[model samples]
Target: MRAPIKTTLLFSMLSLCMSCSNTTALNKGKEKLKARFEVAGICSNYTFSLIEGMADTSLVAASWTNPQSDSTYTNAFGVKNPCDLPEGLKVGDEFYFEIDSNRPNRCMVCMAYYPTPAKKLNIKVLEIVKE
Candidate 1:
């Protein structure tokens, strides 16, 4: 009886250890991905509006087209600012749009509620000559 009980206990401990190691490995992978995303930023000409359009007042709706690739990204929402841009944005203005690489679905600064790593978004204006 004692031998059987010890065997069961040992098996349970080994299983628990395996699960813990797997969890640790998963956490490490997530951390690596987060770090990879942190260093990347995208630059484009952002088009915004002072009045709410597709996005509600709680959201900041904007769009941008990549100059090099001519790739158009539309209806991107900016994250809620601690200090609001009350002056608002012009309909067509270029900016150094900060992007959340980790959350690939939406723009970094103007994002719809999604999986984020508790990181703040950074959006900056970019000065470029018009063609």
Candidate 2:
């Protein structure tokens, strides 16, 4: 009876370890793109530019930066689901900036994964005028 209980415990521990390893593997790529957003502020719309692909002519990259930092990050911001940005961003609106380690030369806006009124980061609205 004692031996059987010990074997069950060992298998449970092994299963937990395997799950942890799988989680690590899944996050490996994202880990490499981790960056720091030390400076925060609003910048003019002129600072932001979209780069389109030659083949699809779709949005391939979003490059922007806060003038104070003087650093730019040019990482590819894919337009795919879960990575898409809301439209209507404009100048004079506030945006937190971050530097992606993978593309240290370009600076990008930092936005929350989801809009919130809770303790989450606030998503600034770029007010639009009626035509």
Candidate 3:
């Protein structure tokens, strides 16, 4: 009886560990992209020039080009701020980020046209690369 219970507990723990590892595997392979926050009219937007790709792009083996086109997208800014982004993010602030599908976006934001894609993409900011 006790042995069966222990076996069940061990199996459950193993399953949990496997799930955690799978999530880590995803984060491990993803490469962060850099972009600068640009202020526009009533709605702010992003500006990404052909300036270049990133990290290992310089290597001859990899195609050197910007990961995303110029201003591929923007964040969903609500009455306060983007759902996941931190406050005080201003124009010309550069940061590294990745698309985070798991991150929920329940914030309400306005729609507007911009230089780039002008679309909203939920992202996880890896770090502030520059400003």
Best by lDDT: 3
TM-score of 1: 0.27
On residues 1-131, what C-alpha lDDT tens digit does candidate 2 reach at each position? Answer: 99999999999999999999987865542321211222223331122222211211232233433345555534222211212223543333333322122332233545534211111111122223323
Query: Highest TM-score: which candidate?
Result: 3
Q: Which prediction has more favorable lDDT, 2 or 3?
A: 3
Ten-residue stretch with the least lDDT total in model 1: 31-40
Please provide the root mean square deviation of candidate 3 (C-alpha atoms, Å). 7.9
lDDT of 1 by residue, 42-104 (tens): 232222332211222233324434444454444444333323222333334333332222333
What C-alpha lDDT, on a 0 to 100 scale, does residue 122 get in candidate 2?
Answer: 15
Taken over the whole model, the C-alpha lDDT of each candidate is: 0.36, 0.33, 0.51
Report residue 119 deviation for candidate 2 (angstroms).
Answer: 34
| Candidate 2 C-alpha error for residue 51, in Å | 13
List candidate 2 segments past 4 Å from native.
29-77, 89-131
Off by over 4 Å in 1: 32-131
Backbone clash pairs for candidate 2 read 72-105, 72-106, 72-107, 73-105, 73-106, 73-107, 74-106
lDDT of 1 at 97: 34
